[model samples]
Target: MKNLFTAIFILLLIVSCLSQSTIQYIYNPPENIKDGLDVGTLAEVNIDSSLIIKAVNKIYGGRYKEVHSMLIFKDNKLVFEEYFSGHKYKWDGDNHYGELVTWDRNMPHHIMSATKSISSACIGIAIEKGFIESVHQSIFDYLPEYQHLNSDGKDKITIEHLLTMTSGLEWDEWGAPLSSSNNDLVGLWVHCEDPINCILERPLLDDPGTSYTYSGGNMVVLGEIIRTATKMKIDEFSKKYLFEPLGVDSSTWAQKFDNGVIYAGGGLIITPRDMVKFGVTFLNNGDWNGKQIISEQWVEKCTTEYRNNKGINIPGQASGRHGYSYSWWLKSYPKSGKKIDMFNAGGWGGQEIMIIPELNTVVVFTGGNYLSDVRVFNILEEYILPAIN
Candidate 1:
């Protein structure tokens, strides 16, 4: 009987050790402070590790099964980084198929429409450096190729309208499934020869800047403006000002180009770790270490909730109401009173770079569940935030 009790005690001890959680990090300390993220313990960062472990298990075991990677940073140090194997949709000759892929610490994942936020940042930098005058300046002034369309209500469109997605062009990207031919962005991509010309040629559905209308054409136009302003491609400009400054030069950043114009609406591929650096830079008010990669004023304007469109039911947005900023998505957590202020760069298939200034935390996600991207909010609320002390 005593030996039986001793065996049970040994089993319990093994279970206890197996259930214990620790922060598993992948970054190596570089000689340059700007080259890598600092690492810390969940306890030291004031986070509950056991709870975080449960969150990671939920991501991999069943819940959020489509998540490719999940990362969290607090106090400017990486606390949790986890990757999962999943399948990505790709074209195979005549049809699309799910290609099995393994996500790790170093692989670059597609960010989809999150590229819009990065493109907006480039425009802000261009404005600060005097490459572009201001967001209020007419977009037509820069694109003489579309000067013919400036006669009607299109004449009222400005750079701010494009950034805010209030340009009110006849767009139907959010109105239909991406696989459907009716989706405007997909149509523009597949059928149009020049996406910029395709967007500019469309008649205005509403007066510019009066109401909200999510348009990829707005982003395509911005990409051209950046090229004209900086006299360089989007990739080149980002390398010089954004990626290199943050020590993300090793990353594989893929940008789409049609007829020499980068597809600014989407098609940016970056690693989950580098995405966290971006969130941290914005959390630190656009400063990376000691260098100002993006101006503080631009960060504030982009993150600020410029328009509150709550209670409006938008298709695919499970959360009924959300505010819009320059190119960032804004929504409060808990969906109730005394909410936690949060802003994110969200993309199709659940790519996110979430920033919560109140908690000094940045959460990054790369997912492949295109139909249910909003489900990540549940993971954030039920698991991630609860893991915080």
Candidate 2:
């Protein structure tokens, strides 16, 4: 019994030591770009390095399985950055299970529904540039091509309804996994030659703007609106107006599309570093460096939660419920006994870009923990916030 106990203890010690070396790097992140971001040490930023290290250890120890990369920007400096190995996939049309590959900082991870937030930005830009009329305008005004879909109360649906996911269209994106044919998203992806028109054809189960239903179809319509208004696809429109202004490399960001039409709802591939640039832009009130890429008013309108209680209660979030804005997510965390609101662009399988306006912080994460149930919010609440507290 004594010998068995000793062997067990030794095995545990070995596991612990191995976990400690999971992310073998110093906290002093390198200054990769002179004009892009300034790098600094954790002490320079006044964060408790020990706490951050503990969190990373836990992630590597399988507490947060399959995290690919984490980058934190605070006080105008990139302070802590880390990467880990994990399995992730690329979607190839109807396969559902696309090419599986190991994730790394060099490899761009699919941002999933976070694409909706980017699509939202494109909509805002279009409004400012006169490519789009107004969020209050009937969506059919922009989509004249799909004018036949206007019957059955669908004509009353405004761009605002789609933005808030309150279009009152019957959608089953939340009930089943995307892999199941029963899921509405799968049906939207598979069934039609004209996917946007198919979404419009969905039965209006409730009065427009009266009910909140999570639907990717809403985004598809928005993307098509941009495409219709401008003579370019949504991806091309965003490239010229949004991406280039922010100094994001063209090669680093790509939108997934069917043939030539970008969905703008769930398919975007971006590096974690580039993701932080977006968070900074929104946090800084639509300004990138000096240029106003998006209107300040639009930024406020999009990020602000609608008055009508159309929010979602996240499963593992300690905050309980989160509000939905024009594609952005709104939640508040208790920090040092004060409420700190968070603006976020979140995606399926753990991709996120989180902005703490109060803290002057932006955190970016990319992972493929679709089924793990390990939330970045839990990590933020327990370790990240407390370190700076």
Candidate 3:
């Protein structure tokens, strides 16, 4: 018995040591910009080295293991970048099983629903270029073909309602598990013939702009509106205005078409570095370096709390308290007893693009923990935020 106990103890020790080593792995970013944004060390950006190491250790040890990559930008330079290897196909109920996936600085990582935020940016650009009239314009105005579907308060829906997620469409993406047959998003993807028409035909649960309903379908409608107004496919339009201007050519969007109309609700895949570039552009108030890709007013309108949705709780969030603003999720992080306002472009399977305007920091995290509790935000609160001096 004694010998057996000793053997067991030794095995545990070995496992613990191996885990520690993995956690201790350091990510050294480039010393200078060769083709993209400038890079620097964590310490150079006022982040504590020991604290960040400890944070990475927790991430490597905990359920955060699915994290593919994490990037931090502060003081206008890339500070920290880390990537991991995990399963690429992590759907909870789907039969699609993929091989092992390893991410690096160059590879594009799936951002899932974070694409909604990107879609919002596309709308901002469309508005700037006068392709779309304004957020106040009725959505039916853009889709005259779908005007026949409009009735009984549906015509009251505006572009702003779609962006703020207050279209009051009867979407249950949050209320039901993604694996459930009743999940509205899954139902739309699997069964709906015309996603835009299906969403527009949804009976209004409440008047437009009266209540907040977390719906990806609203973005689908907005995407079509952008396409109609600009007369360009979303991929082509985004490439010419957004991606090409940012010098990002490696990104891909999973655009689907039904009867010649495009759906841009989600499935935007890009590198963690490129995601940070998008966040930094918002941090710079719609300016990409010198050019105003999106107007400053659009940036403010989207990030700010346009309407309060405190009662609607996100499924896996422990806090269960979040606000919505133009496809972005708004939350206040308690850093050293101070409430730091943070906005993020979040997605299914743990993808996040968080921006802290007060700290002038942008953080990008990609993972494969689909439909599971993502504790990445806690790591940010416990390690990243505290490390900032």
Candidate 4:
């Protein structure tokens, strides 16, 4: 009987040691004064550090390859930040390629279609500054140069329609891979002589705001409108109104093949740390550090749309079809058998900024999963969300 008691004591001691080992480790990201983001330990935000460590281990363990960076902001403080070495997306005329590179806090990563969200913010800023009147204004009001193409209800397209991607332009971007010349988005920047004219000349498939479609052409048109109304280039406008105010570390926007026109649809290249700030701004109802970046009205409108009307199927968006917002993808994450309200600005090759208003959290990721399956959503659903305390 004494020997049995001794064996039981030994088992208890082993289990206690295992439990202690699991909870003993914690990760605290370093603070950078220049970054302008307040830093705090994950414990302060009631996040499970062990889960984050497990997620990082899976990343470094090669379970989720081609991931470059990950960051988490909870309660307006950056609680976790991490970077990894992965492939970066590079492009030729129509072909997309990749190169293995080391990622860091300062490397500016191309955000692809995520630039549309920033462009949406630009539109809100333009309205706040009285560049144009409102989103109800016709696109032709700013693009009178393309007034010739206004026949057959094309002239009826409004800025709001463009923001919601209901412009009704017959654009074929998702029909083929971007590397194929058949993709209209690739042709607009590469083969077409004039992007604005090329997109504007497309036939109107439906009356504006009647159907849902995902096209980068809508964002390009909005960029032109911003330029026309603000009397400045998209890059300059963003720096002055968006990036500068948000304190972005560094950024670059790619231009047209042979012109100065910026591809506001997918041109932004910024560090992952800087990229998440935009989501934070939206989470705070268009306010950043006590300054009203965009009005609260825009924020509410940006997230109001919750219908996945057309059964949009996007790679890396395997949480089923997501609803469209003003350049934002409205989604709900399933947690504890209930869906949590969430939204994101996702781009090709795994660049993403996901915000959960219910949790008051923002998650950022940058990767090079071009033309391939991505592990981003899996990481979020499995590791990140479960880490919340």
Q: Which is the leading candidate under TM-score?
A: 3
Over all chains combined, what TM-score does candidate 2 have?
Answer: 0.90
Q: How high is each candidate's TM-score?
A: 0.87, 0.90, 0.92, 0.90
Candidate 1 C-alpha lDDT tens digits along 1-389: 99999999999998876665333333322222334788776777877777777777676555675888888889878877778888765534122327778888778888888888888888988988899999998999789777877767787899999999889788878778877768988887578888887888887888888888788889989988988888887888888888888888644435454676777878788888889998999999999888888999999998786654233344554554667788988877753346788888888778889999988999999888766535777778887787777
Pairs with backbone N, CA or C atoms under 3 Å apart (clashes), candidate 4: none
**lDDT of model 3 at residue 284?**
92
Candidate maximizing lDDT: 4
Global CA lDDT computed for model 2 = 0.80
Taking all chains together, the TM-score of candidate 3 against the true structure is 0.92
Q: Which residue segments of model 2 deviate by more than 4 Å?
A: 1-25, 90-104, 250-259, 315-319
What would the TM-score be for candidate 4 when compared with the true structure? 0.90
Better of 1 and 4 by TM-score: 4
Which residues of candidate 1, in runs, are more than 4 Å off? Answer: 1-34, 91-97, 250-257, 308-317, 334-337, 372-374
lDDT of 3 by residue, 188-290 (tens): 7677888887888888899889888788788888888887898887888999999999988877876575565555777787888889889999999998888
Per-residue lDDT tens digits for candidate 4, residues 1-389, read: 99999999999999997875565324667576657688888889999888898888788767876788999999889989888897667675222556667888878899988899899989999999999899998899999678888789887899999988888889887788878778998888667877888899899998888888788889888989998999998889999999999998487886554656778899689988888789899999998989999899888877877344445668555557677888888777778788898888999888899999999999999987776677788899999899886
How many collisions per candidate? 0, 0, 0, 0
Stretches of model 4 off by over 4 angstroms after superposition? 1-26, 93-95, 306-311
Which should have the higher TM-score, number 2 or number 3? Answer: 3
